[model samples]
Structures are given as C-alpha cells and as structure tokens.
Target: MNLILKLIAGIVAGILVGLYVPLTGVELLYTVKEIIGQLLTFTIPLIILFFIASGIAGLPKGSNHLLGKTVGFAYGSTIIAGTLAFMLVSAIIPLFDGGLTFNAEVATPLSNLINLKIPPLMDVMTALASAFIFGIGISQLQLETLKKVSDQGRDIIDALLAKVIIPALPFYIAGVFAEMTVAGTVFETLQTFGVVLVAALVMHWLWLSVLYISTGVLLKRNPIELIKNMLPAYFTALGTMSSAATIPISLRASKANDVQEDVANFSVPLCATIHLSGSTITIVTCAMAVMFLSPSMDVPSLVDMLPFIMMLGVVMIAAPGAPGGAVMSALGLLTSMLGFNDSAVALMIALYLAQDSFGTACNVTGDGVIALWVDRFSKKAGS
Candidate 1:
C-alpha cells in the first residue's frame, strides 16, 4: 500500500515537473529513466533463469503425481486468464477508441545525459531454455549441489529486485510520465490508464467468479462459501502485494474451504509460486492497451496474441516477490514477442503497478480454488 502511494506520488511529481519545470529538469528525469531502463533490461533474463530454475528444482520430491497436477492446474489457469483478457480487452477497447496518437508537433524531444549500456549474459529465451534444462535435470537426477546453486542464484536475484529495482520503480515511472508530459501526450495517456485499470479490475473479479463457480460445480460445493472462506487471503494479498507473503492466510483459508490439510499445505505454497492467473490477466490487458496507445505498435490478432499468452504463463512461473514483479517478468516477452519499445514498456510498468495489489489478491484467492481441485483429485485417486 505504501508502494502504491509512492507510485502515485511519482506520477504526480513527474507530471508537475513536466508541465512547469524547465526542459533541463525534465531531461534529468529522462536520464534517470534511461539508466533504470537499461538496468531492467540487463536483469530480466537473470530473474527468469534463477527464479524459474529454483522454483522447478525445489518442488517437493515423493509427490510426483501431486506435483504434476498442481503445475498443470496452475499453468492452465494462467493461460486461460491471459487469453480471456486479450479477448475481452480487444473486443472492448476498439469500441471506445481506435488508438491514442502522440502529437509530434507538440512533442518535446528529451535526451539522456549519460548513455550507459549494460548487456545481459543471455537473452530471455536462452535463459528460459537453460533454466528449464537445469531445473528438470536437478529435480530428476537429485543433484543437490546444482539445486543449491540455483536456489542461491534465486536469492541473489530476489534481493536485487526487492531492494534495488522495486525501490527505483517510482522514479523510473516518474521519468516516463515526465517525458510524456513534455510531449503533450500525458493527459491523453492518463485517460486511457484509468479505463484500462478499471477494465483489468473488473476482469479480475470476473475470472475469480469463473474459477470458483466452475470448481464448485465440478466438486458439488457452494462456490460462494468457498469464496467467502478465501476472502481473508484475498484481503491479505491486497496488503502484502505478494502471493508468497499471503500463503499463511491462504493455507488457513484453503482449509476452511474444505481442502485437506496436507493438500492445502502443499498446494498453497506451490500455487503461490506458479499460479498467477490474475497477474497474467493484468499483463495481457495492459500489454494490449499499450499497443493501442502506441503508434509504433498494433493490437495483435487472436492468433498472434495466443502465443504471447502461452509464453506469458510460462514466464510468470519466474515472477519474483517484488512489487510489480509480474510486469517485470513479462518485460522480455513484451519486447521480444510484442515488440514493446521503451516508452511502451514504461507505460506497461506504470499501468500494472497501479493495480498490482488487486491482481495479487486475486492470485492468492484463486490458489484456494486450485487447492480444492487438487485435494479432490488426489482423494479420488487414493480411493
């Protein structure tokens, strides 16, 4: 919540500076944005490699079937949520406005004082592939040494995100808006930001309804009661803005929803890592909005968007615990798959961070749904 407030302050400060301050001042902000942007690019692949490798390799052994079921369920939910968001946002955004075009005549060009370049050790796809290979090998072969290494790498990256990147985001975002304000397009962009945020929030609840109702019908349980039991976890996530941090409440809530104690213990923690349907929805929605608002990009067709959605589900498995981690994790996909430029990516970060807590709340609440399903499936198999 403090993070959200700080981000709001950043946006307001940037807009004020752009409107009133000298070009030199706004250039300073732009320089900060450039430096932060380059740093983000450098760390994205490392975040993907270490977090995904650690997540996969650290899966509890001796529960192979349960592990498979949990992962399958989590991935499926994420993909479906992302695809659904694309469909809904695509259909709706076009009805309101075709696109938001920047006024080149009114736009003021800003330059960074320092052009620093920091390259990543590997590209996003290579990191993903390497992580999967090493992760599966470590898990299947019981390689404790490599597993420890991956875990340590994950810790290092996690600290980098939590301490450095997350703290710097507000200034990074301020720089983005400051540039937009100078370009005279900030107000138009702000209008679209509000609409897209509302749309994303509505879709979050809508997807939650779909998940719990479907789970209830399949298991012959009261969906409302189950959802009611999960409300504490939902509210907790809104405060923590992290699924992992909300796991304790989620565990109690899942048990209240009648998920077996053992299953809740296993699935809640695992789902915190892998089940990110809510984050996927926000990312997909925000990505589409950024495309519509950017002249350099176009809103993708269903065929084009499907591949991104699929990749998004996989990439989300690597999202760190930092605020706005989902957007950070998906940055590689946005750039490589969707061709998001720096300005577009900056808009995505701003839009996503605005409603990060709501999305996280949905993520943790939906974990209970997964817990219930896994419990039922495991019970039937045992019987």
Candidate 2:
C-alpha cells in the first residue's frame, strides 16, 4: 500500500484505540511514541544546517547572480504565503467564532520519557546564519574537501529520512492521536482545527494561482498547461508529505515543464528546503485560529505579530521536509516567542499534522513556479 495510506491507517487505528481500546493504562504505546518523537527531533537541527549549506554549495561557482535571484524569489514567495494565511484566516474567522480548549492528559510511562536534546552551538536563527556563511564561504574559497563533507552530511540526513524517520512516522502519528483520544480532546479540538485547515488550503490555492498567472505573463506559456505539468509533483507531495522526499519527482516535473537543467537542479532541492509557503501559511492560520478560540489566549495585535510573522517566515525555511518537521522546528518559537501555552502548542501540533499533506502539495507545486521564474530571470540577466 501507499505510504500515505499506511500513515492514515495508523492515525485511524490510533484514534480507535484511544477512543475504544481497553488499553487505557498501557505504557507500551506511549513509551514507543515518546521515543520516536525524540528521535525525529534529534535529527532536525543538524539536518537543517547541513541541508541548507549543501544546497548553497550545490550552485555553480560562476552562478552567483542566479543564486541571489533564486534565494530572493523563494523568500518572496514564502512571505506572500505567510501574509496571505494571516489575512485569510483573520477575515474568515469571524464567520465562525467557535473555539477549542484542550485540557488533555499525556499518556503516562511514555510521557515520562525524557526529551533527549542535543542543542546546536546556537539556536535555530544563529545556526542558519552560520550555515549561510559556511555554505557560501566554502563555495567561494574552492574548498572541495568541505564541500564533500557537506555532501556526506546531506547523504546521512537522506538515509535518516528514508530508513529511519519515514518508516517510523505512522506509529508516531498513531501515538499522538491515541493520546488525544484518551484525553477526550480529540473531537472538539479537531473541529476548530478543521476551520483552520480549510482556510489554509484556500490560501494555498490563491498563492499557486498567483504564481502561475505571473508565470504566464512573464514566461509566455499557458499557465494552465504549466500548472498541469506541476500536478504530478503536487500529487507526489500529497502522498509523501515530504518535499525532500518529493524532490526527485519535483525535479522531473520541472524539467518536463522546460525548466533548464542547471536551474532545475539547484532550485528544486534548495526550494524544497527554503520554500515552505504552504507550511508557513498552515501554521500561521492554525496558530491564529487556536488563539482566537482559547479564552486564556488572544491573537496578538498585528503590529505585535508583524516581526514574528517575518521571523517565522525565515525561521521556517529551516524546517525539514519531514511530516511534522515544520511544527517541530517551530515549537520553540511557538511557545517562547508567541506565548503559546502547552495546550495551545499541542493544538498546533494536531492542526499542523492534520493539514500537512495539502500544505506540502502546495509547496512542491510552487517550486515549479519558482523554477520557471528563475529560468526567465536568469536568461534575461545573461542576455
């Protein structure tokens, strides 16, 4: 069966067990779940650092202008997505003023499992700064050995994704839902999450349409036909829910859309790492909806939130392409920077995971648009 199906089955089974399984006090499932969660978190910081650096180093030494344009445009698209989510969710939320409050109990023995953290020398923001310098610095200095090391680090991350992380995701998902069901918060909170999910999906479509319309005007191709070519990537991401996993497919789709080989290779993987428009939109929307509904929380004023939204846009660029990677990376910011209580953070996790596949579909699809844009711009610059 498909990986997505397996994951969905895990979710379904976990919810059922949580809701009906007579294993309420069972420590086995909870223990396993916490262990898996810790493992995934363990890989995130290093993976982000290495992946960003490797993607930077992957660009041709002579292609500094292309690199700048690619990064600039990718960051621009993400900003559009984050802002769009904020707008759409804010406008639509008054129509349904419903809220969710979660006072759920974490499963015991497993809840006792310690979070094994190996923090980076600096936090996420600092790590990205360091990565940018080292990644770009190595390329300019012609340090082939360090470049080789970055490539190896990227490979190790790839192995972790395929052999370890992806394989374990279903069980991890099951444990999450099961715990929620046991706590009796699943049904009510999911209702609020549903509203956030719909808003995020609509914003995703809007951003993709904007991307394709711009492509049509600049690149002089039928936007519909271009969108059609990208559908395969979108669908692949829908199933895998991992842009990193879908990179190979996304690259193939971009090539078929007539993106030049050099542009496709550098932009697809780099965009997969950096282009998290859909995920950011979904997170922002979900976080907002949850905040609106919770009595103890109020969605911060826009002026207060503007800096956060901007920082969040960049911070999420480091989000790995794993299933719950964006939220996992954003956890610290959500709690510390945004003042989300434990309950709010828990709600964010559920909401983010619920709609992650659609966000990923939007993300990989947008990569095609970015690739098309970069190709047109690079040609003009060269001319």
Candidate 3:
C-alpha cells in the first residue's frame, strides 16, 4: 500500500516538475530513468535463473502425483488467462477510444545526460535454459549442494529486488512520466492508461468468475458459496499485495470450501508460488496497451502472443516474494518476446504496480479452485 502511494506521489511530482521545471531539470529526470532502466535490465535474467532453479529444486520429491497435477493446473490456468486477456483486450480496448495511438510529432525528446549500459550475464533464453537444466538435474540426482546454492542465489536476488528495485521503481516511473509530460503526451497517456487500468481490473474479476464457475460446474458445487468462502483470503491478499503472505487465509478458505485438508495444505502453497493467472492477465493486458500506445511497436495477433503466454507461465515460476514481483519476473519476456523498449517496460511496471493488489487478491482467491480440483483428483486416484 505504501508502495502504491509512493508511486502515485512519484507520478504527481513528475508531472508537476515537467510542467514547471526547465529543460535541464527534465533532462536530469530522464538521466535517472535511464540509469535505473539499465540496472533493471541487468537484474532480469538473474531473477529468472535463480528463482526458477531454486523453486524447481526445492519441490518435495515424494509427492510427485500431487505436484504434477498442481503444476499442470496452475500452468494451464495461467496460459488460458493470458490468452483470454489478449483476445478480450484486443477487441474491447479499441472500443474505448476508437483505438489510441501515440503521436510522436508533438513529443519533446529528452536523452540521458550520461550514457551508461549494464549488460546481463546471460540472455533471457540462456538463463531460462540453464535454470531448467540445473534445476531438473539437481532435483533428479539429489544434488543437495547445488540445490543449496540455487536457494542462496534466489535469496540474494530477492534481497536485491526488495531493497533496490522495488524502492527505485517510483523514481523510475516519475522519470518516465516527466519525459512524457515534456513531450506534451503525458495527459493523453494518462487518460488512456486510466482506461487500461480499469479494463485490467474488470478482466481480473471476469477471469476469477470463469474459474469458480468452471470449478462449480465440474465439481457440482455452488460457485457463489465457494467465492464467498474465499473472500477473506481475497481481502487479506489485497492488503498484503502478496499471494504467499495470504496463504494461511487461503488454506482456511480452501478447507472451508470442503477441500481435503491435505490437498489444501499442498496445493494452496504450491499455487501461491506457481498459479499466477491474475497476474498473467494484467501483464498481457498492459503489454497489449503498451504496444498499441507506442509508435515503435505494433499490437500482436493472438497467434503471435500464444508463445509468449506459454513461456510467461514458465518464467513466472516462483516469482520473487515482493511487491510487483510478477512484473519483475515478466520484464524479460516483454523485452525479448514483445520487443518492449525501455519506455514501454517502464510503463508496464508502473501500470502493473498500480493495480497489483487487485491482481494478488485474484491470485489468492483462485487458489481455492485449484485446491478443490486437486483434492477431487487425489481422492479419485486413491479410490
């Protein structure tokens, strides 16, 4: 909540500065944006590598059946949510403004005062491949030593995110807006993004309704009652802005839905880590908006976006436990798959962080659905 407030403050301050400040001041702001952008880019691969590797290696070896079912459900849910967002946003977003497009003519251009670049140790794909190879090998071979290393590496990256990246985000965003304001596009940008944010929130609830209704029909349960049971978890997650932090309430809610205790215990925690359908929806929606708004980028067709959504489900594994962690996990994909530039990525981070609490609430609530399904399947296998 503090982070969101701080981000709002940053946006307001940047806009004020851009309105009143001289060119040098705006240039200074752009410099800050540039440096922070470099640091964020450098961290993206490491976040993907360590987090995914540690998550995979840390899985409980004995619960293969439960784990496989849970992961499959989580991934399928995420992909479907992303796809749905892409289709809906593609159709509906155009109706909002008859399609918003950036006009580069009136834009005042600002450049970084200092040209600095920090490259990643490995590219996103390389980091992803290496993480999978080492993670699977460590898990299969019982390589405790490498597993410990991956865990430590994950901890290190988590710290950097919590301490550095999260804190720096407001200023990065402020700079982004300041540059836009100077270009005379900030007000239009804000108007369009306000619509985008509302659309994203609507999509979150829409997807949640889809999940519970599908689960209700399949399990022959009242979807409303199930949603009612999960409301406490949803509100808790909105406050905490964290799926992991809301797991306790989520477990209680799942159990209240008559999910078996053991399944709730296993699936709630695992879903907290892997089931990011809500976050995926927001990312896809925001990514599409960014593409539509950017002159340098083009909106992708559903076919072009499917592969990104598939890889996004994998990249989102064990996202760092911090505010905006899902977007942090997804930055690489936005850049690599969608060709998001620095400004596009910054807009994405800002737009995502603004409504992050809602997304987390959605994620936590949806975990109960996975728990119910997993419980039913586990019992069937036992019978």
Find the candidate with the highest TM-score and give its number: 3
TM-score, structure 3 vs. true: 0.97
> What ranges in model 2 sit over 4 Å off?
1-3, 13-28, 99-122, 214-222, 236-270, 312-332, 339-354
Q: Write the per-residue lDDT of candidate 3 for residues 103-123, one digit (tens) a residue.
A: 323355787799999989999
Q: What's the distance in Å from true for residue 306, model 2? A: 3.8
- In the range 7-34, model 2's lDDT, one tens digit per residue, is 6676677778786666644345655676
Steric clashes per prediction: 0, 0, 1
Relative to the true structure, candidate 1 reaches a TM of 0.96
What is the C-alpha local distance difference test score of each model? 0.89, 0.74, 0.89
2 or 3, greater by TM-score: 3
Residue 271, model 2: lDDT of: 85
lDDT of 1 by residue, 235-268 (tens): 9998999999999999999998878888888989
Q: Candidate 3, 317: how far from true, in Å?
A: 0.5
Q: Cα miss at 76, model 2 (Å)?
A: 0.4
